[model samples]
Target: MRLLSFVAVFLFSFSLAEVGFAEENGSSVSEERLTPEELDYLVNEVGNTQEESEDLPVEVSRRLIEEEAQVIDSGSGFMVIYDPEVTKPGQISTFASIAATTLKLGGTVYKVKSDRSKDDKFYIYGNFQWLKTPSYTLVDKMTIGFPSSSGLYLPTSGGKVKQHQHRYSQDQQGNGRWIDYTIKYSPSNWEPSAGVAGSYDIRASTSKTKHKGYIGQYVYVPTSKNGKINIKITYGHRRIAGTPSVSVYPAGLSITPTTATDTRSYALTLSY
Candidate 1:
């Protein structure tokens, strides 16, 4: 006749104190320490659930006990597990709960910060540690100034094309002239798919153009004379990924008269 055994496991919540001992050779023992709350949650919740299981074979019951002990021993304070899918600020708290549960189950959790801004924040609970994502600048904001002239001068030496400002006629009633400009990006020995290559914003007169996605050749017409073009370019890196360098080169510009025989001159300056 087969023998059936019922396993009764009792879990008591208590503070886990730091314990250290020396081996026979005098080597110190190092182990992960769990907070009181984490220990209480793990034992009262996880252990009690397992204890409620009904009778099973003696071997199966023994195996289950061993497995539970192994799960409790696997947690580490030094190691972190990163989940890149959790990238948004709204998902931080929800993910933190999942991370805490994972930690209780002898798993690891990594703290991650959103890339939106320095002021944007999130927290990881199980580890009870704060981690900050390092900031890196891929492209510095630069401004190109031009003297008042009737013609636009486009640069001949720049990398792949990213943006283009076409020469277009403005309203005859306005004193503005069209300035043709181009923006290009060149990666420094890195794949373009590694991270965001770059982004740019162009502000001229009363108009503002922002580019956050897609790097491609495009034309824009901003009517301005003796006005400034404010340009700011930024690059973002993937979570936990090291900094990658890139260059944003504002190519030269081409000038065209708004109207035939219109000799009105204007100075165009670009700043970020």
Candidate 2:
């Protein structure tokens, strides 16, 4: 003894526009036939409700999406980051991406061209964040430059041992010359019950060496020209965590002023 209720445009695509009509009490729950403008309004409402609602104008949006953005290092190494999010050249966010990639691949020495910049962030990429890992150290060679370092870490979660670095470059061959100013090897008795879900691992990716105490940090304050954030690389594995197998990856982006703006980059790199 029951009858069914219905809507005519019920077959519309399940986008933001059609959402309000699906609910009974929604504003667009029409008693009369919906006009094209009303339908268009519903569509607009849907677009206005998306999670990516930084809600920039379409013209602004067109300038934000980047395709095949490339930073070519004259040194035969180029870095790349891919996303539809980039919109134009000379964008601040895009410049940050370029700098971070350069530092990780060993372009610690760089220049920034502010005259070439036209946005809020680094115009050509220049921020540098040194890795806070067991294998991280700053070796002061006669030259003021970033000591080739790795952007990886297995940081602890608690205790006085917040961050530790164990990997280092020993004496050349066996001459016994300490690479950095001070080198230390410490181990954590704490064990992590679970591992992190990294970009490299999706499901229940547990570290063989857990993270319960100390933590790695990406907090080097860069203070040089050619913008070199030095690192000290040793020959074999040292021990910041209990096992030497854990890896670290750089974790931040920032600005480093370059030359004539468009002629340089803001190089940033580090790990925590």
lDDT of 1 by residue, 1-272 (tens): 12222221111111111111222111222133344554454445334223222211122223333333212111212223232333456554344433311101111111122233422211101111112111211221111212223122221235432222111111111322222122234312211211112222222222122111112111112224223332122222222223333432332221122221111111222321
- Those runs of model 2 whose alpha carbons end farther than 4 Å from true positions after fitting are 1-154, 157-163, 166-181, 184-272
**How well does each candidate superpose onto the true structure, as a TM-score?**
0.16, 0.15
Q: Count the clashes in each prediction.
A: 5, 53
Task: Compose the digit string of candidate 2's lDDT tens values, residues 115-229.
Answer: 2132111111111111212121212111011222322222344543233222212222223222221222232221221111100010111112111011112122223212333
RMSD of each: 29.9, 23.5
Q: How much does candidate 1 score in TM-score?
A: 0.16
Span of ten consecutive residues with least summed lDDT in model 1: 100-109
